[model samples]
Target: MNPTDLSLDDLDRAEAEIETGKRGMRFDQIGSFEPNAPSFLIQDVLERDSQAGVIGDSGSGKTFAVLSLAACIATGKPFAGHSVAHSGPVLYAAGEGRAGLVRRFHAWAKANGVDPLNVPLYLADRGAGLIDADQIAELRAAVRKVAQLHGVPVILIVDTWARALSGADENSAADAGQAIAVLDELRREYGGMTTLVIHHLGAADKTRGRGSTALKAALDSEFLVARNQSSTILLTATKTKDGPTPAPMAFELEDVFLKTLEDGRKVSSAWARPVEYVAESRPAGKNQSVALEVLKQLYAAQKQTLDGAGFAGREALVLVSDWRQACEAAGLDRRRFSEVKASLVDSGKVFLEGPHALLDADAVSGAASESGGTIVPPGRRTHSAMSEIGVSDAFGHFGQNPKGGR
Candidate 1:
């Protein structure tokens, strides 16, 4: 066949054929790639161009937590003190609780001191049936319009995978897998927007959602939201394909008055607010605190430096020499502090990559910690790989920091 000889229809047909069949690319056929860190939507919580799920038991505040995240992303604000790498329109498909969802959204936005009416957050009250091709088309159209208006990619959040799959059998692996495929199709059709689906935990096990293992296996990130004994809402990332699992972030509900009925009864709803950071519960030896402070300062500085170069998505690397200087500045012995690097990495506060120690993606950078001046101890560990390491009321400064020219 002559190159540049095919008609448009002929090329389309050829492409359709390839799409309809199983396809594989040989290793050699794949071209070389420059290593770039994955871009995140909610910094450590969710990555861009990815599909994720939030699974929790009933009344676990799964919906509230997810909406809180969506609100942050829509406003380019911080969520639970973690940075939002980028912000844009958020399309929320309210499948199960439309009325309550609205009140919760208002409460969350107001509680966070964000103006809901101004942000690019849209809600689809049509309920699930998103698995249906017609409904998917409608959603894509709506998202496209919103994305165009906002000049940014849309984040589509489908609340409750079970409701979205309305008629499908949740226990049937084939049915669940097919539903996921439909969601993936919607993701691709959007030309690379994020799709986050809310889900429920399995009846017997409290781990992942109720579905075929393939659902969890296919996700780029999986989160588990639950309430601790203290009644604090904890959001933990259980699985992350491209990045390290982030430490748990806690939220405490705050009440927002909705209205007063004619009968003089007060109507109010509560939404989650990030708990203030408390210094690590475990006592840090005098030298250890100094050592950790040194690393924290360096990481924050590196992160700020990278954000200037349009490479903030990549890990911030602090050189060993820099660490030594920080230790000296913090009045700690450089040699004794050398072991602190290993300790930080072991404790999941940092990562050692090549000659540099990269700040863990969710680690509160020194600048943020310094500004907040508090840190909570790591959350208790579970069988799952993730746990809370620190807490901070690092909100408010998001979107206020001046951006450097890239």
Candidate 2:
């Protein structure tokens, strides 16, 4: 292509890209530009007006870890030992599992002694549809309402990226980009915004997020949620574009008592605590550890739901088959399940009766297993908290008050 072949329309397009700062930077504007050090919403975790991803294998406690961060940001509490600003409200666009989130948030509020309803956290009514422009607009309207009542939401969280795709092909780069653009648009609205997207890892690879690499490429920071060989849930800061990558944070899943059913059974929710906070009374071998943790996560998320296939009078139960499948899907050996279950059963940590598995709460409770955690319903809440401690101490305190939560 010679200079003569350059059409006027091509020049106009190039000029527009340059003006929008999406492509070329003119030499004249370079002299006036000033570069500043990166600012953070959550120090070292989320840079201002940037997008981040928390991705992991299914049943790896990805949602638990992400909710922790969102809760911290909303309440001005420390996040995994990182500093947080009251910054603004948190807008949670839950694509699925809204019921579970309510229970989990209730447990979290109880643990930290905060009233979840008073926290400046707003939840989207419908699932986030990032692939479609119309849905994005609806989300924007919801945010505006949140801003009017509480404040501008600096923290925007998409519980799972797959649900927000709305039939778009995640494997297709073009389709994926459309979804990424939704967050980008929201981020642009606020200069110090942070978007956290929860996603799943590829089933085969078990390392990277599932679908197009475009999602990974678009993130300013990225975290990998996984269970180490010890069955400890860990949040690894895989990438931080503006700062030095932080060391991996280890977490232990603990159940918070939500409520009791009429049948004399208790319903609980899972909470991710810093390793030191959880008293490890139950001893499990490598294979047994992962298997137990997976089952605990499954049951914790939906403890209120009575499994129809479960044994009569059993409220919190995970099917042995589902646990085995999840373990094998996560790269753990399928044959190891038999030994793992037997070991857990013998150790009295897990009770395998017939077709289902139940974790012995008493065995796991080194200190306090069942706390008087109040169950808070979903939709609206006003709560807040702040602590000058590590992740454990930060969330351990009680008696925080609610502000103007929605």
Candidate 3:
């Protein structure tokens, strides 16, 4: 049809064709690669236009971790030493109880010294299913309205993927991919925004999310939240698409007092707080290696005993005599054993209290200890091997009765 003689229908068809062509880019039209913002939503942890999957066992503190992240992003503050590049309004769609989430948020804020009322953070009125197109659209509309009201870009955080799925088959690749697609769509519609989905870990592996592998493959990053032997929450980046994985962080759950009820009863909830990090000590030589093996054995036994008896944190203790027995069983030379024991003590891995020794529960792995505190054999303050067979076996074999010390 001639341009001037074209009917309305012909013009509409032409416009549709032109738009379709625009969707496909030519090789020359594609620009050269450039880095995304150096620090994004949560610095190296989360980037703009990205989605991350965080999974953990029940009570592993995944929800708290995400909440903390949302608060940091909303205020553009540093989270556990990591910077936040994009600070804006955060929308938390609680798949669980709204009241409970609010209480937890208050507790976290109080514990971290952040004023919750001052931050531009909002909680969704209710949860929406991810697979339903209508629900997704409705959520987007609600989020957009809220974002506009707050005068900030929206960073949507879905509390739990399973709750959003509404009993859909998470194992099915199609179902999982569709859920992830919904998250991506939200990201794209919100001006390259970030979305974080809390998930559950597989019962077997406990490393990745408990769903179709596609759910993991589709994510820009994946984090595993777990409680270590010391009952500390450990957050590790299992996978990162673009940025380098940051070091693992350890946190202790601290209870924040909320308020008193009419009956004069107090209430409180837990918040994740960063703990002091302590690096593992290394063996200096063959003698030290044997001593370390002994320490490991004794500590394992001590921890097992404490756990079996329902003890945790500072309440747990291991007798010094046990360490001495472990030393004897391992056939560690007396002089070398003393040096290794002193090193472990000086390193803060093993705390000495009277006639007992226990592992430092508050110490986080990968943290460096104070320098210039080398444990030298009593006589040999210097590096010389004062290998006298029994020249003051500093950790003398103090009787063999475990109950005696306890």
Candidate 4:
């Protein structure tokens, strides 16, 4: 048979028919590779054949952010200011059950003028357990069935990674590694498939993923959805294998009125929208408000300009030393002030540049998020081994800098 005369379908059939003794691809078959092997699923952010994570505290809008991305891929709409390079079917497994997810998607469709029945988006309210062979089989079977009906799904999103674990200690590398392996296997079963799992943040520090280091090790991309000063959330690409991580980006979740019940009650859900960078802000917390007041006093006396590409536009910039002195003079302990300062920098509410700090203009007031729900950090020692992990890992950047760029 002439290789040049064979169609891809024919080549696939030939490859399948090959005997067990002939395991690998023939040299001539190299030309048959998928032309878009690693094409972007979300332009400049995510790619095919990869696994990624969107991690945050509770009610931080991580769910809304990811759902919006999935909707964009399903309907070929740009997400958070980035165009979709490739769009297709999506399988979203809701580990927390069908509760708010369905409404959220409907809200997305309604807001985007898309008929829910038209797109190849499938949802399973109950997600599969990573360590459960039976559930894994069932999930894969469902994916295959969806492919038979619609086209192969471009991405599979697991809502909450912890909820999907059964009879496995998430902190154990062996268990976490095994679960991750199963996900990787499932991802590879379909060509050009993306497995993006949603995870949670550590409790005490409110930094890094909640579970084992192994989970982060397997991720090809990682995005952090955090509350900014303007009552909006910042969806940042913390790690990207293909290129340098993009600059700081932000978005807001707007409430969408889904429908009215027969009883005259109105139903509503929130959907994410690409809003211009609102200075990567965050509203002040109880402790932060005091530090903020001190900064303001110093600013009233004198202020400096932090001119740069990523610095929050002309805002209240003050010397870190002066602010600390003011805080100390006001009965704020040095130790306590350090923690407060770290919190601000870590959350992007305060940007540090060469001993100077710039406070986000909108970081003065508001709730934790648009949902008005704050995430209570959980200490997952067995699950989180970040204490032993370095600041920088092979998988991605672990730096705590809240600047817009790397």
Maximum-TM-score candidate: 4
Clashes of each: 4, 7, 1, 7
Q: Could you give candidate 3's per-residue lDDT for residues 138-199 as a string of tens digits? A: 88788779867886464788878888888689888988878888887777767867788888
> Which residue runs of candidate 1 sit more than 4 Å off their true CA positions?
1-31, 261-263, 276-406
Please report how far candidate 3 places residue 1 from its true position, in Å: 33
- Backbone clash total, candidate 3: 1
TM-score of each: 0.62, 0.61, 0.63, 0.65
Candidate 2 global CA lDDT score = 0.67
Q: lDDT of all the models against the reference?
A: 0.67, 0.67, 0.65, 0.68
Ranking by TM-score, best first? 4, 3, 1, 2
Candidate 1 C-alpha lDDT tens digits along 1-406:
3568889998788778778784423455335767688888877678888988888889888887888889888898898888988888788887777888888888887776777789788888576465567876776676667767776565788888888778777777777777777778767766558888899988755645887777787888888787755667767666767665577677778889977899999878888888853322334577767766656665555445445555535444456555655565556665666556544543445444323444443455345454333222223212232211111111122222212211
Q: Which model is ahead, 2 or 4, in terms of lDDT? A: 4
Ten-residue stretch with the least lDDT total in model 2:
386-395
List ranges where model 4 is wrong by over 4 Å.
1-19, 22-38, 280-406
In model 4, the clashing pairs are: 203-378, 211-383, 228-281, 228-282, 229-281, 229-282, 229-283
Q: Between the candidate structures 1 and 3, which one is better when assessed by TM-score?
A: 3
RMSD of 2: 19.3
**Candidate 1 deviation (Cα RMSD):** 14.9
